[model samples]
Target chain A: MMEFLQQRLTDLELFGWDEYINYWFFLAMMALFAFELIVMAFKKAVTWNLIGDSITNFITLFAYRFIGGLIYILFYLTAFFWVYENFSITQLPLTWMSLLGCILLADVIYYWEHRFMHVCGLGWATHTVHHSSPHFNISVAYRFGPLDGFFPFFFHLPLIMLGFHPFMVFLAEALVQLYQTALHTQMVKKLPRPIEYIMNTPSHHRVHHATNSKYIDKNYAGIFIIWDRMFGTFAEEDEKVKFGVYPRINSVNPFTVFFHGFTKLGKQLWEAPSWSYRFQLLIRPPIWAWEQEQKRKREAAAAEAKASP
Target chain B: MNFFVSALSTILLGLVVGFALSLQKAEPPTEFEKYSSANMDFATMSEVGYAMAAFGRESTADYFELKDYQEYVQLAQNDHAKALSASDSPQVAASEAQASKAEAPTMQLAQVEHPAKPKAKPSLKDWPKSVIGIQRSTELINVEKVWQEFASNSALSDQLDSYTVSVFAIYSDFNSDYSRATISIGYDKPSMKGEQQLIPKGKIETLLKPSNYGNNALLNAWQDIDYSKAVKAVVERRDYTQNSELTSLFVIYQ
Candidate 1:
């Protein structure tokens, strides 16, 4: 009986806690608590919904990272094996050319790749899972599947080609990931105007995740919000709006998630009139499809008027 | 008015002396007390006595101006040494080298156990003069190789840079005898200097990292080892680099 209990206890997830005394986890938790306390100290109602949402989000994030991290490791191992079988990695030059180029290129590629994930057909397949949830928090950040490996290969292909060792790329990627971890919170609501102009913030992110008609397909920035503002895709987050995609993915089932955007793309492609129409169905921004569907409704109404007259 | 002020001064002086004597004759604190007054060190001990006369137990203040972490480490070692002496151990604190008495030197000595020199200090002083110092260096680790063996080990790499930038101590025995110990870690930063304490009057060109050992286990992503192994291993690696006679190999720890 004792052994069974011990096994169950051992199976309990540590949230990567088996290492240090769970400093980062405690820090996140204390931050939430401190925020709640500030609210209570002012005698404001401690919103139970926020507390529930944070817990649900944290658990979701943990589950995804735990499972997805294992698969990511497996794929990375294969890549490592492939590298080892190829050549001696020693005496490789870690030059300024590769370092600066990889950083700027990675950032630029991340902007486009992420923007495509939010908009295009094949890219939307995996990314729609992130937008499915009505709530937004850090957990929503990691609610991704094991298939994220394929994209990074393309994004970081330059690292391998430039004789930059796989390790530098790996380290750089980890630092960027560690940064993205904090970006998914409701905390730090607004940044200073300079960083707001250049960096992604909760305000800009709220607009991205907002399901409101006017707010859809906007504010896409992986690191630099300037990309969105410059490209005319930016929308200032309005408080009246709520989170999640329009006609939400409502199910908790993973299958429904995996197929949502792909199904939408397929249906639109089938009904499209021309080759360009079909191409736009797969390649255009999600809002462009919404506009096309609305245009079809207007044309049908106009044809009805002419026939009746 | 003058006569009254003189009387008041005499009474105040008496009160102060009485207060001082009470403090000196006070009994040892109870088990619940935070520390023994004598263990508080000489300078703090005097202040504690003054606090006792002035405000008693409420006035608890302590300070130590440690120039380096070695002092705390030395205190722990010295305590152990004192304990070992009580058990009739062969070693005596007096015989150890004052300069080479820290943990790193002792660790280097521990590697080679010649029973004859059980209490004798290790002669790190006579080792290679070509590559001996500490500061910083950069090394690009083969994370792919390390990650293969221990991919699940997420402590270092989950944060995500494959190569660790680090620093190490370099020592060259003879022209061909070189070794390095990784001392620090940064990101993509190589070739650091000016962290060592001692600077000779001449142009002693020691760049915490010497061009030796080519980022062996010292700067390797697997930053695991005691100071002794690090010192000795770097020295062994340095020996090969000194063959160039002009340039020595170095390693960085991340």
Candidate 2:
């Protein structure tokens, strides 16, 4: 019986690491959906619009998981593993304390990475899709862009080289992700004050998703709220938060949802007056690109007006 | 054999369960079209209000905090009333009446000969004596339209009926290569603060570039000058890429 079980475990190895992680992640996703349905039965918050948004999100997530396998091999194995094997300061035993320390370190790295994603133009192009949905629900949690998965792993590479096993670092990240999945709903309002103060609750996450002036570019944390508080990106939920991006995307097309920001960036890159301006368009804060493009259009129109007569 | 059967059964069970979960539809698919940018008409909607909240930091005026959509509508009405009253002031009314009379000759000439070239430049002989600060030159562009265009993206125009719109231009004093111009449109009565320095320098040429129509460019046909007040529009020209210093101003009051 033991030999037979061992053989079955080997069969699972045919799918590789991403599938192994995804198999369990898939089950967790299903459980979250089930819980969401149960909450919907009693709460009127679950609308048809949310469901459709969720379906599109599910499709995106499924495709990401499938393609992410290749990304994992190409970028993760070649680059991350090389760093971990060659430059690890020292090996820490896979003990409980080491796991806790790794989670704490990984959470801090995530905070910075998440903040950069919101603040930078190129980063926003990849990350904004997650916040594109106006509706905040369980399905919104699944709205992952393919590009998002490729770059964020670099943030955690430090942890792998600091003597934490790469798998353990990934485990911490997955745990953070699972916690974040629960933060996507409006069903749970403010938790207890201490819990709310210390942890990244739904309230804090809602502020993160909001387009309100006070809320924009605030509250970027993964598992803990301390990082935001320490870093000054923390914003309290003062005003009624409006969800989704500003100058919001107006199309229901999945392609538009996925690629509108990239298209805007691409156009600016082509029309930019100089290489420096083009580089600025790519790497500057998202608002800087938007303002520059607007200035360019205004100048062009003004030129046309002058040329007419 | 028992372990093999158990493993196979677990795999089969997970697949069936996962498929079943996937089949769970989200009631009626969510309506996301309303959120699409195509359906959202920002042009027609008020954008200046949002602009004021978002970009009004540089302005010396007070920022009105709007709590909700209702407050926005209420404030918009209040601002419109303020503007109407400001325009109705005796001085403005007198200037406007005089402006209407002054605008007739140019309109008639535009219709008969050319719309672009009408009337000789206003006589700068009465130009105020220059003291020290940036020089000034005032010109009346025309008197045909009075409208406001929001300068920034994502402004709440409806609630922002009372905000200012600035227009900038460039002028060469026949010395430097590049220069800038600024024209401001607002409910505050226009003032020619620097009207004294309308003295035209050596071979002055107003370079009408494509960038002149930008938010800082004036679209109004005329400007009404109140000489006592700090001129609402600060028009300046500067060296290429040099910090734009307000050197010359052309304010035409109607």
- Pick the lDDT winner: 2
Q: After superposition, how far is residue A266 of candidate 2 from its true place, in Å?
A: 2.1
lDDT, residue B68, candidate 1: 20
Compared with the true structure, what per-residue lDDT tens digits does model 1 show for residues B111-199? 21111111222222323223212333222233233223222333332333322212122321212222322332211122222223221
Task: Find the 10 residues in a row with the least total lDDT in model 1 chain B.
Answer: B108-117
Candidate that scores best on DockQ: 1
lDDT string, candidate 2, B116-226, tens digits: 111222223423223112222323232112211312212222223322212233222321211322222221112323222332233222222212121222333113334
Error of 1 at A14 (Å): 23
Lowest summed lDDT over 10 consecutive residues: which window, candidate 2 chain A? A6-15
Clash count for candidate 1 is 32
DockQ of each: 0.01, 0.00
Candidate 1 recovers a fraction of native contacts equal to: 0.00
List where candidate 2 sits over 4 angstroms from the true fold. A1-29, A35-48, A297-309, B1-254
